[model samples]
Target: MERLLVVLCPELLEEQEDGRAARTFAGVVEVVESFSPAAGAVRPGVCAVPTRGPSRYFGGDVRLAGLVRTALSRTDTALGRVEGHIGVADGLFVAVLAARAAGDEPVVVPAGASARFLAPWPVEALERPELADLLRRLGIRTLGAFAALPTRHVLGRLGTQGSVCHELARGMRSELPGYRLVPRPHPATAATGDGSAGAQVRQAGFWGEAAEAEARAERALGHLEQLLPPDGVAVGRLQGGRGPAERARLVPWGGRRLDPAGPGPEPWPGQLPAPAPASVLARVPASVVDGRGAELEVGPSGLPSAPPEQLSVRGGPWQPVTAWAGPWPVDERWWSRRKRRRRARMQLVTSCGMAYLVVREDAGWWVEGAYD
Candidate 1:
């Protein structure tokens, strides 16, 4: 069975100016990921998190919901304490509706009760104006009324989109015929990291002034320069840099950075291998780690064994470190609705003095990469 959590933040950007709203939402998504990786933005003020996996670790659904609420409450988005609703259910439609139905607390629908919980809600909750109009005309105002109609008849008249609506009304999976449904930012107007079309504050001309738009765009390039790692150099700089007008055309606010030499993201410094995704460990060890990555002790099973003794090494059959560097942290995917990642990377030199990249994530520690 699928499980979903809907976080409704009506005031997420109510206080911000044009550009700041998108940035604020990005920051908010980051906070959600600190609680679970299965979360993503549904819209500007709404986010959906799949909690089935993470909830088990935090006890049960109710307790996990409480923890999520606490996290959102403690999150200082600098936009103030915007309230959030946490709804856990079998489907996104009922889960979101349940969130809106809640007060200052969370709502958790039992495994198979989403359809029943959704039944009494009015057709308006579907948020489809045209379909609601049709349903009203037919005297089918509540979701239960709409769900009672034969699926074949609905499909014959309203087509695939109607099929989706019917499924939603019945609290079933919303997918079109012969197609796998892909998740989208709920309420389509929600801006992705790069901003939306016709609402391009950061991607296009700032504040929509055609005059000096090029100049503003040129200045954005300057901002991009500062964001890159010290070792990160534009490819254009290597092959005779292109003019500002050419660079200005690239979208700046998108999560993917632009390369002056080409259109794609600027290559990672020295083309370092990106972090490899791995299985979450069933058990995490307790260990003390600080910047410069020294005196780490781990058990044979690759778990942090214990706190390090000052100036003394705690040796085990596992990889013993001779030297180390970095607690270099990564906070990736903050710009999109699907926020992910909270981990620190450390380079360790084993007894053989061979270096390995290790990561510490919420799920536990794992060796990320190896130096050749």
Candidate 2:
């Protein structure tokens, strides 16, 4: 219905700091209809914004996209350097692919031709494994190949999803968009993203300084611990913009010491390593995504039962179910010997709804799908 843009830009700072060969390219997309990360930028670095409303107000999709580009350019100079590559297709997914296929100029996928454009791409591009595997087994490789097959057979083979893909071959990308749940990044002594806090980094160097790291770590823990209730749950999911491996470093204390003098984490040896920037931790709070229509209900059986109205989770009266749904009984994957479970069903929900699952499991209830 509209032109979705995937703007590719080169960072001058990275080049100036390093070399021309070390150019860092950024893709800032203007997503008119979805909340996808690739569709929009939603972080400290860059983001994507939807254009549906803009299109309605500005008379057309092209004008909406143009307005977005202008807004992006004006908001922040660094954010402004975006290079426009437009993809006009029936849906976001197809538009993005069309844009990807475009070279330097803005690529546009004309409406009504999305399904045809997508036919040549690999089956893997669809991002749905269940559908991809079934198609691959039937000797279908490209979207076109699958499209050429009997629609009824494809649907029967892959279930209801195959019909969507069949239509996609004709250039109708109908899959939902993807949005990145930006995890909260833990604050580091070296990290200056947040200001106005006590024990500033340079004021207290993390490693080289005499006890600053310990102090700062204490302050952070105190901040976190304060968030916990006194009598109930002790260890709850910690949510931040960062992941587990990306979790912030805390100056370790001796069991229950409130204020610690850093001799360098006692339990943590001097040579201990830090986690990767992208590492997501089990302790870290996972993101709960929005699912339209269906509602999640935690059955009264103390465990998840057949389709319920909504699901409920209480992490020991502390963390509660933020959202949930779906015991959407998946009877497939049974053919695979590895998947030969007495019973296997996936509860499609996020950490919020899962907290209750964990508590119930800890209380001797049958555990179900995790936030993972």
Report the lDDT tens digits of candidate 2 across residue range 1-372: 444443433232112323231122222333322333325422222223344555566766566555555644443333344444444455446655655575544455555667667778998787777878877887888888877876546533553345455655654434332311122333441265644222212321222232334435545654554465322222222223212222233432221122223343233211112322232233322222123323322343423533332333322332333444332222324588776422222233333533222212211223332433
Q: How do all models score by TM-score?
A: 0.46, 0.35
Q: Mind giving the per-residue lDDT tens digits that candidate 1 earns over 31-119? A: 77776876776555667667877788889888888888887788776556667777888755667777888788899988777668878
Instruction: Give the number of the best model, judged by lDDT.
Output: 1
Question: What overall lDDT, based on C-alpha atoms, would model 2 receive against the true structure?
Answer: 0.41
Candidate 2 deviant stretches above 4 angstroms = 1-84, 177-372
What are the lDDT scores of the predictions, listed in order?
A: 0.57, 0.41
